[model samples]
Target chain A: MAYLELNNVHKTYIEGEEEILSNINLSIEEGEFVAIVGFTGSGKTTLVNLINGLLEPTRGEVLFKGEPVKGTSHERGVIFQNYSLLPWLTVEQNVLMAVKEAFPKKSKKELTEMVAEYVEMVSLSHAINKRPKELSGGMRQRVAVARALAMKPEMIIMDEPLGALDALTRGNLQDEILNIWGKDKRTALLITNDVDEGIYMADRIIPLRPGPRATLGPEFKIDIERPRDKTEMNDNENYKQTRNAIIEYLMDIGNERKSEAQEELVLPDLAPKDFVNQFK
Target chain B: MKQSVSLNTAGKIARFNIFRFLFQGSIAKVKQMDPKVALKKVAISIASILLFLGLWHMGAKALYNKEADFKINKALEERGQAAADSEAACIASGNPDCQPNTLPSPAQVWASFNSLLKDHGIISADKAAFKEKTAALNAQREAENLDPIVYTGRPSFVDQIWRSLGTVFAGFLLAFFIAVPLGIFIGLSPNLKSAFNWFIQVFKPVSPVVWYLLVFMIVKTVLIGSPDDSSFTISFVSVGLCSMWATLVNTAMGVSSVDNDYINVAKVLKLGTFQKIFKVILPSSLPLIFTGLKITLSVGWMVLIAIELLAQSPGLGTFVWEEFQNGANDSNAKIIVAMFVIGIIGFLLDRIMLAIQNSVSFVKTDAI
Candidate 1:
């Protein structure tokens, strides 16, 4: 069985209404880094929530280790896109909250140390005592990253965690997350809009077509070696080919959507009254 | 050693500078002030207060003269020119009997305030002396399981102030305890909120007098057989019922309007319902809760005097009522003093609540 599997899942917010996600099927093996890249409002978050057991599919099932996914568990840690850190808590406390729940048996000292380690991994040690409001957007996201990682979940699910960050901060965070995942090769899924980010950090990059009923597209395997360098990626032949194919496919679907949306309206033929036509 | 000596001298200079700043109004300190904004603010505040007092004095003088003229004209109409002249002489002589008892001037109000303080001191001394005189007799009565001899004198102005504060605090606590938990429960579910909505709407606008009357009826019946007085209980209960609506409404709104993102975070963490409330909901809703509490305190204070007077309780409300009824030479001035005290105390209560709200809240909540 795959480490995580979605078997022909469909999701709709209301009954008898158009679905948000339809007939979605995907599988990720243990120790795999998978990225699902999509346009904004493509139901990528819905897919991530389904996997994390925050939402149930309208049809079919999501399986984790051959068991059906249920309500949220610490084993599947989610890094939400908006950095859902509690405003009242400091950076260290936010991470500690998750760490304590995930490892209830650990001593207070042990938990503190673990939180410190994760925060240090994200290079936010200097801001450990600061509340979320005091931190910048990028720093808050880093704290969210630390909070998720500190829990030591079996799988990490990120929903555009770096989307709000600037390009430089996004690059740094991508490298940090990749380095952390490299340590244990845990099952990780990243949902992002940035193609370069997906290419750099993920082993297999899949595209989610834009929705009313969004579904996953074919996967592209990155043949690039581990510890890929960004400076040399532009010069690489394989990188160029994969990038072009993905961009072209995305553009084709976008144009297709536009064309589909532009159905001609049948106008009723009518004559203007003599009084109305006088001014014209 | 030289560095340590210099540090000591530096500390001494700082201490002296603080003293000068507080007491002497040192010009050097004023010159050293970088922004000058604070100094300017202080100057403005002093000028405004002086202006207010000046206006008050002028208004009081005008009213006094008007009443004096009316009194003299009446005397002339009743008797003759000699009677009017005697009335004028009486007014000029500052005779307490013939003086106009209209609004008191600022100086008269100040005099009344000092006299109230002196009255408080005399009452304290009298009570102490009575206790000393009855000590032996009280000890004997206590052995026999009887109530001790007690002083039955009227409460001083200071005592009335203390009593009013005590009642307000008691009422505030009652309001908090009853409103917050009920608010939280109602806030948790829309169904409960709807269930309780009609009841809240109906009772929220009821006046303190009606609440007091209702409480009086119930308390009078409840304590019929008991020997203890029920005035405090009735007044405080009425005050609580009168003031609790704002807190209840605010708390419900705060709890219900917590950010969806925080709720989502709580759910993702899989926190238990209890943990979710204390850890997430309560902390997030604290700002609103404090706003409600601040309003409740001020409302409670505003109604407390009226409630106390109605209940015949020994508080500031009753004190003011008695002085008004007494109609003594200094009665108007005493009433004016009470007015100033009430306004100042109300202001202080608000400031205290604001300080507490700011300290606990993540956001700096300004007074509404």
Candidate 2:
């Protein structure tokens, strides 16, 4: 059985109203790294939020380890977009807070060492004492990455964690995350709009359609060899094919949205007065 | 220490120099200040203050008679046209009748402050002597197992200032404790927030004097059978009630507007309700809460004098009122001294709050 399963999950924010997501199904096996690629406005965040148990699916089950996911748990560490960090706390302190909460039985010295290790892993040891406001956007995101990894969760969820960084910083962080995940082989779900990021980092790529009744599209399994290098991937024929396929799929969804936009705002012909007259 | 900061504007560079000067002694601060710019700002600030004092001295000296106003009025009254008319004419001519009555000159106020210090020293010495005389009687009472009597002598100027400080702090602390938990509760639940909104709005605009009266009445009634109903209790409670709204409103606003990402992070961590609030909600909301607390403390200090006066409490307010009523030669100058003291203390109190706010806030909050 898969480690996490989404059984035909559907979510509508309002009662008896617009459905944001419908028939979203997925099966993530243990130690698998899966990335969901989609166009903008694909409700990509909402899908992972459901899987992380930050939001509940309206009509389907999000099962974690064979049980329906209820709410957020330390078992799934989430590295959110926009770097949700406590601005008052330093980078080391930010990771230490999560570490302390996750492993209450660990001594203070052990937790401190663990926090230092993760901060070092993200190459942010120089900025370990700086608060979030003092750090750059890319540096703050690195601290967020360190904070999540230090928790030692069974699964890790990344919601476009690299979305806010510059190109150079983004590439460096991608390699760092890949190296860490390669060692542990933890169950991971990454949500991104970047096709290359999905192909390089994730084992399997799933595409989601644009929302207001969005659903998952076909999955692309990357049969490329492990421990991939960014420069090396460009030379590999399989990586090229996989990246092209994902981008092609996203473009198709983008065209679908353009047509859907035209059809979206057609108000019903029946007005309130007409409905009242019919009632009378 | 050798970090370079290039600036586009001279004004911004000057401001940065000032900031660097303020933080010069801190160990890890890397700001390199231009000494010329720092000196220029300091010189300008001191020059303006000196200019203000010069203007004040000139205005008061010109407006007030150096001497002999009483003699001029008396001579006019002796002519018996009308005493009131003579008094008015004498005042217009800058006679010495208005010496003690006119707006006090800066020098006179400064002299009065010094005199008040002398008076405090004398009063303290007298009180000590009185305590010494009563020591034997008090000891006898203690030996007999009766409660020893405390010295109920008149407090001096320094004592009054000290007492006022104590009372204001007590009031601010009361407001803080009462408002913070209530604010958190209201902030967490929308229904409670709406329910509290009415009470907060209604009571917030009520005058400090009215609050003082309400507190005095309630405290008096409650402590009718006990020794706890001092005017001190009444004044502090009134001050607390008057200033508590700022904290309550700010705390609720802070809690409700906590960032969405932090809330999501808390949920993803599977934090329990208590942990979520303390870990995510409180730290995120601290900036606003501290903003509220600073305002509340200042407001409490502002209203404390009025409360003390109305309650007839022994603080700076009472001292000012007593000196005003004394109608002595230096009474007006003494009142002016008290005014400056109050203003200086209020500024210091605000600076203290600003320091605390900066430390607690995630960002280095500018002293607004």
Candidate 3:
């Protein structure tokens, strides 16, 4: 059995009168890095939330390690796009808070050591004592990463965590995350709108089609080596082929949705009238 | 000896180099300093004070001159005639009749001040006499087995000042005690917020005077069951209720305004309610909370004085009232001085609170 399984997951958000997600199904194995790629408002966040037990699926089951997922727990740590580190707490404190909660019985010394280790892992030991406001966007996200990793969850879910960061900072954090994920190969899932980011970071990239009811479209296996360099991967033939394939698929979905919208707007009775009476 | 001499020579050279470096650095720093900015600040301050004093002197001269064009001169003349009449009455009755309605000139008020300070020791003597009278009164009541009226001895300017300050502080403290915790609870819970919000909105708009009257009557009829309640408890309660509304509203808003991201962080970390409130919510909301408190305290002072005036409580407001009623000419000058004193004290209090707020503000993380 897959380590994490979703059985015909369905999420419906009532916006005036519209159902959001019909039936979404996916299976992720332990030590597998999976990225969900979708356009904006493709129910990507809802899917990630369901996977992390932040939001329950309306008509489906999310099984984590053979048990159905319930409400939020420290067992699955999530890194949000906003880098939700407590502004009042120093970076070290933010990390330590999670560590302490995850392992309540651990000694202060042990928790302190764990916090330090993670801070070092993120290469933010220098900024550990700084509050979120004092740090730059990248540093804050690094702190958030440190905080999530400190918990040592069974799986780490990221919801476009680097979307707010600049390109240079995003690339740096991506490598740092990849390095961290490389160590223990823990179950990881990333929800991203960036197609290249998904291909480069995840073992499998799943494209989500947008709609009044959105669902998984196609899974693309990223047949690339581990610790892949961005430049090197871009030059690789397989990488280029996969990137083009995903983009082509997404563009096709976009075009289909656009034409569907046009069809909906079309009024058959409003077509051009015959001008036979004009000559008379 | 030769080695020691060589070492001394090296030390002297090092010291000379250090002195030269220090002198050069000082000269550079001084040269770079903005003397123009300093001079401008000084010039502005001097100009402001000069303008203030100029206005005051002109107003004083106009009042004294009694010119037909100056409307205040007519008022001053009327005041002087009233003072003369009161003085004649006092001489006839062998009692001082200085009061607000019959304001004396600065010269007359200054003379009276000197006489009171040097000859009769009126301020201090009156205070002592009043204290003694209260003590005697309390003793008599104790002996007679009557309800003891706490006679706050005869009021001096200082005594009145202290009494007013005491009431203001006591009322402010009471208000803070009630409002801060309640505000926090309301801020944190949406249900409580909704429940109590209407009540707060209703009460908040009601004026302090209304609160004072309501509380005064309640205390008079309900709590003490007597019109002669001497504890000033009613005054304090009235001030507290009136001032507490602002603090409560502001604090709740402040707490609610705390960044939602902090709350999310707390949730993800699984921090307990207590930890989250104390560590995150309280610190973030502190600037606003302190600002609210500062405003509440100043308003409390104003409300306390008004309450004292209405309640006939022994404070500065009552003193002002009694001086007004006594019909003494010099009393107006005293009132003016008291007004200035109140303003200065209020300004200082705000500055003090601001300093405390800045001290407790969130520490910059980069300082680490």
Candidate 4:
């Protein structure tokens, strides 16, 4: 049986309205890293929320480990895009809250050590006592990552976690996340808009065609070896072909949608008013 | 020995650091402030206050002269020129009976303030003496399970101020306890909020006097057989009910408007209902809650005087009422003194609440 599966999932916020997601089907085997790349506002977040059990599918079934998903559980840890660290709590406290909740049987000392370890892993040990307001955007996102990872969930779900960070910070965090995921080889789902980010981190990349009834497209398999170096990938054959193919496909669909939306306006055969002639 | 000495020195340094930390923020702020701007602000405030006092003095003098003239003219009309002259002479002589019983001048109010302080001192001495005199009798009364002989003297102005403070604090506590939990419950669901909306709106604007009467009716009957006084209870409860509406409304709004992101985080963490409220909802809404509390406290203080007067509680309200009824030579000045005390206390209460709010809230907020 697949580790996590979504079968014919359909969702709409309002009853009898245009569906935000329709006829969605996905299945991830254990220890598989899957990335879903899509444009902004393409219902990517709604898809992530459904898989994580934050939202229920309006139509179909989402099964996890051979059982149907019910509500949210700590097993599917989500690193939210907006760095939803509780503003009132310090970084350590924020991580500690999640760790304690996920591992209720763990001792306080154990939880504290786990929080410290994850914070250090994200290179934010110095900011352990700082509140979210006191941290930079990149630092806040790092804290969110630490909070999600410290719970030691079976799956790591990221929703464009580095979207708000600058290029340099984003690069550093991508490697850090890759390193962490490689250590455990946990089942991971990364929802992002960056095509290169999907190719680098995900074993298989899929595009979510743009919505109001968005569905998944054909998958691209990345047969590249583990620990893929960014610089060397430029000279590699598979990387060039994959990057070109994904970009071209995205552009083609994007242009197709644009043309479909642009209906040529036809004006009626009309002339200027004859008021001047009438007055003369 | 070296380690022990270092530890001792470290402890001493830590003690000094405590004081340093307490004042460091304000000292830094002052140091960072531009000297010229700070001076200008101080100068403006002083000038405005002086101008207010000058206007007040002029108004008082004009009213005094008008009353004096009217009195002399009435004497002349009733009697003759000699009587008018005598009346003018009496007014010029600065007799207490001939003084205008109108708004007291700032100087008169200041004098009244000092006189009240002096009266408090005398009353303290008298109470001490009374305590000494009744010590043995009180012991016997205690043994016999009888009420001891108490001081029959009136409460001093300071005592009345303390009484008012106590009542207002009690009222504030009542308001907080009643409003916060009820607000949270109402805030959690839209249906509850809608159900309670009309009820809150109706009661919010009801006058303090009416609230006092309502409370009095209920409390009087409930405490009919009890030995303890119910007036204090009625007064505080009335003030609480009268002032709690702002807090209730603000709290509901705060809770309902918590950021969706935080709520999602709570859900993702699988937080229980109470856990979600405490860990996510309360912290996110704390800024608004504090804003509500600040309004509630100020409103409670504003209505307390009226409630206390109606309840006949021994507070500044009753003192003002009594001084007005007394109509003695210094009665008007004493009343004015009470007015200033009430205003100053209300201002201080707001500042204190603001300080507390600033400390507790994650975000900065302002209150006046």
Which is the leading candidate under lDDT? 1
Candidate 2 lDDT, A111-224, residue by residue in tens? 999999999998988988988888898888888888888888899999999988888988888988889998889989999988888888899999988888999999999988
Candidate 2 or 1, higher TM-score: 1
Say which prediction, candidate 2 or candidate 4, comes out ahead on DockQ. 4
* Clash count, predicted structure 2: 4
**Interface RMSD (Å), every candidate:** 1.0, 1.3, 1.9, 0.6
Cα deviation of A204, candidate 1, in Å: 1.7
Model 3 earns a TM-score of 0.79
Q: Kindly report which residue pairs in candidate 3 clash with one another.
A: B98-B328, B99-B327, B99-B328, B102-B329, B104-B329, B130-B153, B130-B154
Tens-place lDDT digits, model 1, residues A24-106: 99999999999999999999999999999889999999999999999898889889999999999999889988887788899
| DockQ comparisons of all candidates to the true complex | 0.69, 0.58, 0.46, 0.83
Report, for all candidates in order, the number of backbone clashes.
0, 4, 7, 0
Interface RMSD of 2: 1.3
Q: Considering every candidate listed, which one attains the maximal TM-score?
A: 4
- Estimated TM-score per prediction? 0.91, 0.86, 0.79, 0.92
Candidate 1 CAPRI assessment class? medium
lDDT of 1 by residue, B1-368 (tens): 99999999999999886554333323444566765776796799899999999999999999999999999999999998999999999999998999998999999999999999999999999999999999999999999999998999988999999999999999999999999999999989999999999999999999999999999999999899998889999999999989999999999999999998788788777888998899899999998898899899999999998999999988999989999999999999999999999998998788777767766788875543
Q: Rank by lDDT, descending?
A: 1, 4, 2, 3
